[model samples]
Target: MCSHYDPVLNAQKLKQHFGVDDLPPGLKPSLWPTYVGPFLRKHEHADVGDEAVPFKELMVGSFGLIPHWAKDTKIARQTYNARSETVHEKPAFRDSWRLNRHCIIPAEAIFEPDWRSGKGVATRIVRTDGKPMGIAGIWTGWKNPANGEILRSFSMLTVNADDHSFMRNFHKPDDEKRMVVILHEDEYDGWLNSTAEDARHYLRQYPADGMRVAVHD
Candidate 1:
């Protein structure tokens, strides 16, 4: 699971990189479960009446996904990650995937556990060239029936990485290795607007050579 990540860019840089006029302010430098961070998603026509339709915008939303049927937010703890293979069928993510509620989650680095030391060690993974990653994500808006408040949240999609040269090093030894789906610079917009079947083509593993890691005690 990608429990932690860092979005190191400021408001101005995000706007320039994502090619948008307005940027949200709550781009948390470091994000963990329940933390709010910047994400890019195309707004739905009904969600933004009278506003430009199909326009992508930056919004600050919570990290974990809260399914529409969820009775409370506690489900987010486990929904932060949705496996790519089953995302379209998973109970928590299926609705969003079917509705084409895709999002691009920007991050400078992701935290993982390096188990090479015969014990788990915290590790940070980043691009060797130091570019921010546009990770593929799916989002949903759950309205609280009690108070009528809408909660928007998202989950990063992960693919099997047991055979990956670099990504296989993270996670527990007994657990299946996995890595987030890092979208290429040009693929960001396409992912946000693509249909569920079309988006499947973008769920491949990133080249391991482009990534480097740092271990922490």
Candidate 2:
């Protein structure tokens, strides 16, 4: 599961690569659980049949999902990544999953720990083509009752990666290996608009050959 990553911070790259027209303020260069970052979701006006409005809209949200019933935002630390197989059953993620609140996390790279060397070594993973990765996710809004402040948050969707030649190398030897779902460029719109049933088709693992990993110093 991804807990640390580099978000696409360049305005030009956000626009050219993700088709996001504007960059919202307060996005960080690096993100961890509870950190605010950029994500893409279907524009609200898209269903209105307006051809002039873009299909996707850029949003800034917490990296970890905060359920509506939560008392505070601290729960975000434990809800950063939702397992694809159990997302529908998990209380924190089920509502968003059922509602088809799909989102795309725009990331420059994801950081994981490599344990092959007998010690945890930080590694940076990115696409071989040097393009941004559009990771699959689900989003929702949580309101703080005390102040009535609305906070938007999301969680990355992960799949088992024990059989993946590349992804299986990360994490601990005894732990179940996992990897985030990286969607292909062409599937962005399909994923954003897909129904709960169709969203499963986009949760598969990304091909290992298309990715490059290096030791992070």
Candidate 3:
């Protein structure tokens, strides 16, 4: 599960990357499950057109997913990641997927536990080209019944990485290997708008050769 990442870009950079006109002010430089960060979702009322695709303004949402049917926020910690094979069938994520509530979580770098040296060590992974990655995700809105406050949250999608040359080096030796679904820049729009059948094509491991990793003390 990817629980942390470097959200190093500011609102201006995010707006430019997603081609949006507005974003929330004062975004943080890093984010964890409970932190608020920017995500791009399709506009709710975009009209059918051939000239241009309508994009919704950038939205600030929490990283952990809190399904609308969830009774409380405690479930979010366990819902941070949804496996690709089950995302369409899981109770917590199926509704969002069915409704086409998809999103993109941009990250400058992501942290993982690298066990290559025979001991678990923290490692930061980033693109070899030094550009941010658009991780595929799903989002939904939840309301606190007590205060009637609505909160939107998301979960990163992951796929099996037991055979991945690079990603297989992380996590515990005995644990099941997994990696987040990092989408190519060109697939951003398609991921946010593609039907479930077509979206399956986007859920695969990014090439290991395109990434670099640094072990931390």
Each prediction's number of clashing residue pairs: 0, 0, 0
How displaced is residue 89 in candidate 2, in Å? 0.9
Evaluate all candidate structures by whole-model CA lDDT and list the values in order. 0.85, 0.93, 0.83
The residue ranges of model 2 lying beyond 4 angstroms of the native Cα positions read 215-217
Which rank order by TM-score, best down to worst?
2, 3, 1
Error of 3 at 202 (Å): 0.5
In candidate 3, what are the lDDT values of residues 156-209, reduced to their tens digit? 999999999999999999999999999998898889888878889999999999
Q: In candidate 1, what are the lDDT values of residues 26-60, reduced to their tens digit?
A: 46678888888778898665356665564677776
As a whole number from 0 to 100, the lDDT of residue 8 in candidate 3 is 42
User: lDDT tens string, model 2, 175-213?
Assistant: 899999999999999999999999999999999998889
Q: What lDDT would candidate 1 get against the real structure?
A: 0.85
RMSD of candidate 3 to true structure, Å: 2.4
Question: Which lDDT value does model 2 have at 112?
Answer: 88
TM-score of every candidate relative to the true structure:
0.90, 0.97, 0.91
